[model samples]
Target chain A: MTTSRRQHTLEVLVENEPGVLARVAGLFSRRAFNIETLNVGPTEDSSISKMVIGVAVEGHSLEQVIAQLDKLVSVISIKDVTGKVKEVHDTQPDYQN
Target chain B: MAHIPTANGTAMTGATSLVKSLEAADVEVMFGLPGGAILPAYDPIFDSSIRHILVRHEQGAGHAATGYAQVTGRAGVCIATSGPGATNLVTPLMDAAMDSVPLIAITGQVPSAAIGTDAFQEADIRGITMPFTKHNYLVTDPDQIPGVIAEAFHIATTGRPGPVLVDVAKDALQKMTTFNWPTSIKLAGYNPKTTPDAQAITDAAALIAQSSKPVFYVGGGVIKANAHKELRQLVELLGAPVVTTLMARGAFPDSHPLHMGMPGMHGTVAAVTALQKADLLITLGARFDDRVTGKLSTFAPNAKILHADIDPAEIGKNRHADVAVVADVKETISALIPALKAALAKNQPDLSAWLRQMNSLKSTYPLGFDQPEDGSLSPQHVIQRIGQISGTDTIFTAGVGQHQMWASQFISYEHPRTWLNSGGAGTMGYGVPAAMGAKVGAPDATVWAIDGDGCFQMTNQELVTCALNNIPIKVAIINNESLGMVRQWQTLFYEGRYSNTNLESKRVPNFPMLAESMGCVGLSCERPEDLDKTIEKAMSINDQPVVVDFRVHRDAMVWPMVAAGTSNDEIMIARATAPDWDSQEL
Candidate 1:
């Protein structure tokens, strides 16, 4: 049975460096994951950057997405804040044509 | 804190420090080829305790390293020069990644200044290997060498083992710096969960108890986690029929009554049927690979899966798990045993009918092929005879083909790490070098490379390396004189228009002569009666490598095959009543 797609916002902390964002985006695209929206910037700690990524996934895919994201060496941590973040922040993901 | 070249307590080349760090990691053996870029790294080998095996080709180094890692459960190290050297290592690295083998590939890059200027023998080693590696590093700074090596080893060996590459620039090896080996890494992004959630375990146990037709589907993760003992316990406790994947051949003892052999595209009818009919699939460390799950939509339609794997990506990749337990397979099995026992004590599900059904399938459609009355040798028979003659502790590696499937079907692996093959990648030319590497890792174990004739031609030059190094691994080339697997496909699906599958020539290179020329014993078995003696002679010579070419039937095909994208339920067993496509008018 197909589970309804739920929109989830995840805040990912990663090392600030070249190709870090590309690595993150590459993983999502390779796995064929539907990214709703993504925003990136430097955190309070300049050495680390924070990426707020919004994606619509099934209940089963939520764990997989988080797990796959966590596998990146550049990614520091990821937290799912679906309800915590306002839905207004979500935008159409760039990769979806 | 052993310093590299502490002459007046200062100055050391980057290569010396690199060797020092590798020693710190207790790397016993390194398989590699040297070139202009990596020449500096070769200088320190004379001073270091590590044994360097110079391979004929760079690809051999990668496969040999993989073989060592598979058996030793440690990161096998291989080195290569830049450009073509690095590119050659690609197949093995990708193969290692696919199989989750722990391996570390070190490639020397062009001088820091010369990089990306189209310098001779310059390649983007790090960028080339980025997709498949667990992690990688391009170290332009000599100071980071020790830490990078440490991290590479740590990452390669831990939590779903895989290949990691460290591409060191030439200047890094030529320049001097003090060595400081980082004892631990603080990678915030790379923590692997080793413990299963308590609730997930409880849920899995409840599902296990409630289901009547349950099957324990095991894979390579059990062996990697050293959970075979726990696996056996779970099997005995539940009394459920167990089906091992191609990678999980030796993970479970096949002699046990409940063992139902392999389950997949070329698996036994009993194993394939059991999974299709199972109500619950307790998957331990095995992914639902497409080969195993033929026509995914119809695969195990009735079964609710409980997946226990350390790698979370594998959990929901193909089939959605009812309970996904992310932990080391050994630990997960250890936790599940007690919970499973508790559930059973509360109420045992009736499995007598299921057991009866399994037995009936096993007896009715047992794995077998037609034996010609003309007394020609069959590849399956050759494998069986080898199993009988060779010691119980023998390790077998096979190149991919009909021979690989035949070896899997015929060989009974009693212990973990005893059966090594390239399952996920289905890589040909893997048997020779991999067996040599396995032999190097475990010198006492009798290692045999069960290769197809076509595959043996790919990397059999490694036999020279084996013979010279005194790595006496037996190689049995199932010489069907054709690419047997593809020929079988062409025969069945492509209207028997065999396209370049036949390798026959007027003067076929004498395998025995070739082996003898390579400084090893060579033998051949043409008749069925001579098979026992030839294998016995091959097994007796333990000092150096031996190659045996067994001429078998060219037209033989693997049975109980689930054609690609076809339903598992529609497994074809007998050849007498062929499929409709074969009999169709062209």
Candidate 2:
């Protein structure tokens, strides 16, 4: 079967609160997006949490989705790893300085 | 000592380490009942300003919260204690689940020490509410309370926005932990956004540009997203006529020349027959429910449908949408308007011949009703009079049963969200409180709560709320004196054994007298001539709530029914020689 293929990874920063996860999932479920996996964890600082998501999609539509997701109040930042595969997007700056 | 108002606008219980955090998260009101299990969390509420609405019944509290959310377009917050109290909140949670409302249920569970041994007032609330809620969490540790509450609200209001239950042990609320609100949110499974692809919009527009005849099938989403201007622009842009789904009554002005009013089994003949002939059909925000499409296979069979909706499952669940666009109806329709305008500028097809042909089909199947010398006042006639009396912008809410179906069939809505019925859930006894909510939402406009005797009694106690609040919701009860909707089935499908469907309301507190007892002016009409005066007095009254008991035909049945479990293709219309009244099915 012929198919269009593209993939993207995004980092989301969200408030570490109760209903936040449900709200985020609610958005994806509403759009009927099929996600491969989503990993959420606390940052080095307790005030914000980080989430990494991988989604299989068609064309460059990932950018448009990421742009819209970024507009939500709970979302702090988003990075499309489809092209930035070699580097980790969300990280604490090294203390070596 | 602090008085910080919470989400529901009442002052909260006690002081909490997360007082500032809760306040920051827009904690305005919370509906809750207090108990020993909730004492720990109660401490912070007293010091904070978060408000709580102490409810008489946990179920009512949850439903009230649901009503509030439906009107405000926000998440409803409710609280309950362990075991029975927690169980009471479950019904409304499930209701919210099916209706897709945003709800946050905070229940206090037994402390961790007393769990598993069946702690007093302890039941497995988290496990019970798990399948029903969109998501739930159990806070075993005190440190997680702040983050959990914050996350719970976010999740409940986002995405498809269903209720989320949070079970907090007694110890967790009292725990002394530093609270700092998080600024950003992240989750793997949940992300909500409406992004309609430009190409699909173009594809849908191409079909419109090519078809000899096309029609715009509008639904509630046009109003939900406030897309009236865009919808009008597109229909005018493409020069096609418009028809509305039930929820979409107000998208176009009913008086507009191009507007064909509501379409379905009870829809206008023009709307129904035009769909039979159209080559391309553009649907916005409306799901082709069985009521709208009498027989699925026969509904708009010749048309290549381009369906746009915010919900994805609706696209192919019942009817297949050729070019499915999953986005907010307003966003999608707004986008279509411009694209179709561009396409029309380049090449405008001649659809006048098609329009003339559909107009002819419309003339053939005009929507009409009869009041023939039949002694009983027709319920359809009553609704048509309601349509004739109330302006197009009037808001109408119906209790479940024959009355609701009649309103859906006869009345024409000229605005969106003006006609509110429990569409997806079909909950009885929802009309009064919902109409009360509609009055709350639209105070100046005329609001009517169309009810059946059986459904009215279920939530009749709320009539006190209407009188006390002084919100004049015109209550029109189609008193057939039986469980009308169910009786219709028992009469048609079940051999006329008629077990348990009969009404003994007269033996009890007859409905009209009960209205007078509730301090609302009451009127009863059995004759056709009395109908007009009764309705006029009802509209004129502004002092309190009012009820008009129009004694309709006792055995009236809603026609054009698709029996449950039967596919949408088979419909039992209102015709004679059917139901086989002469024989016995049993």
Candidate 3:
């Protein structure tokens, strides 16, 4: 199976804490996955923060990464903005079906 | 997900899930020193698979992590407590930042309430690290923990990769929060294009084809980007000679015909001559650091430079590039390779004249030093002999300042990550522990930590770690009885004011006693005559880490010294070009 590479923009809700950034990227780097862009900032509530991670993942790797991310302790939400790309070659038509 | 490891699950105590989250990130190692504010981090550290190697000093933690990253090709992680602890990590972070190493430094901060209140050991860590780090965050709440860590690691090892700082406040670690790792990030400002621009590649190729005397001045950027294969292809395509900066040691195979060795301060005479004669200079992944440029105007004077790097800030930071292509080194080289192939029409031109001049310089000077035969210790002779015995596979790590420069100039590091040092950060006490870490990474390989007296003393306490772990590392101490580089400056510029730079009192300190206290063996090299046997014995002892203290000349200085703030070209060779020592072999 060919690994489909796509850049996805994710806006995540997180609990801002010490060493969280290191914990987070240490996640991806440890997996040896590639993150293309990443920026983080606080939201209205000081307790909550927003993280945007632009990572390149193969179709196979995306499912594994997302499943692992869903299991994090501080993550509130994860939204994929990769649809921002023009209807590129159908990535994982199996997911839609 | 109650799989979250928590102590008591109380509202006052934050979850160890953050550490668990780090495990998901695959952080197998953490080099840090513990302190009061960071207790929560330690609580979970023991539970996670992530091994925490306690460095003797906080500064050493950063160096250890940097050394780890340098050899393993991974983002190095370091942690420290609030205030002084955090401050200790700054030099190493700056080194990682300067050299574009993928480094993440996490420090504990006084709780938000204690901040700005002159609380015990409280300092504005984020503020101090702002300029040095590629990005930094003062994590405020438990919810923000996972995302911030993800971003920190991402920012550090990406694009023009550098160090990233994450200062965690005390309260945040005490709060309870659910963890969710980030699967992706959306950083608009950080767009790193891996593919080179077609037009610029074509333009660069055109510049190369027309120039009669072309040279490749490669640097560390190429190594960081893992572009060795592409760089070699580009060099071969251009059929021109290549000269690298100290930081760009392994960008090209040192054995290649076109490779002219390193240039700049203490640079090879051949490489320096080649840089002076080249008409077209193709620089890759290197900043024109002053040490590498000597007199800037006179440097590559005849050559028009084509500078390429991922960081745009470095495009014209030191010397103005005739043409600056701001792109990743690998991308730029890949593009250039194709362009050159497409535009290839001529075979290799005759570089016989240039080669002859370089060959003559190599044979005449040949970077040799001899101590009074059968008299005492010579660091040069020790290092040279070590190089001969260790062969190329045995990796070498050096502490800053003069010893590092000397190692870079003299050692032929054939392996890509074989030579590790505090290049940009120039941390003195980095060698011992970094060598310790290198040995840990590759257990079977012989690891040598080459250090100066100034550097060894800084983190020499780590000698105990080697003893405890029984990590057999051979250390060659080039003890000069002073902060030799600073003293060198004092001798040349400061009119020998002789302020606090001297370490004469400790010149003959009982290093073996110090090592014995830590359960490690130490050997002293007092006679320049007994240098070879001392080195051989040090390298042979596999029982514990060994220290070979070579009592080098106290007044010794690294030649080709460039005065600060001067152009890279304005260098002082041999302290005013007068023959201080005869060129003849003693």
Off by over 4 Å in 3: A1-97, B1-15, B346-350, B370-374, B490-501, B505-508, B560-586
Candidate 1 TM-score, C-alpha based:
0.93
Flag regions of model 1 displaced more than 4 Å: A1-10, A33-40, A52-63, A80-97, B1-11, B576-586
DockQ of 2: 0.05
Per-residue lDDT over B185-219 for candidate 1, one digit per residue giving the tens place of the 0 to 100 score: 77767888899999999999999999999999998
TM-score of each: 0.93, 0.75, 0.80
- Predicted candidate 3 versus true structure: per-residue lDDT over B390-419, tens digit per residue: 778888998887778778766776767788
Q: Which residue pairs in candidate 1 collide?
A: none
**Interface DockQ of each model:** 0.51, 0.05, 0.02
Model 1 interface DockQ = 0.51
- Across residues A41-63, which tens digit of lDDT does each residue of candidate 3 receive? 99998977888888787533565
Worst 10 residues of 3 chain B by lDDT: B1-10
| Cα displacement (Å) at residue B427, model 1 | 0.9
Candidate number with the higher DockQ (1 or 3): 1
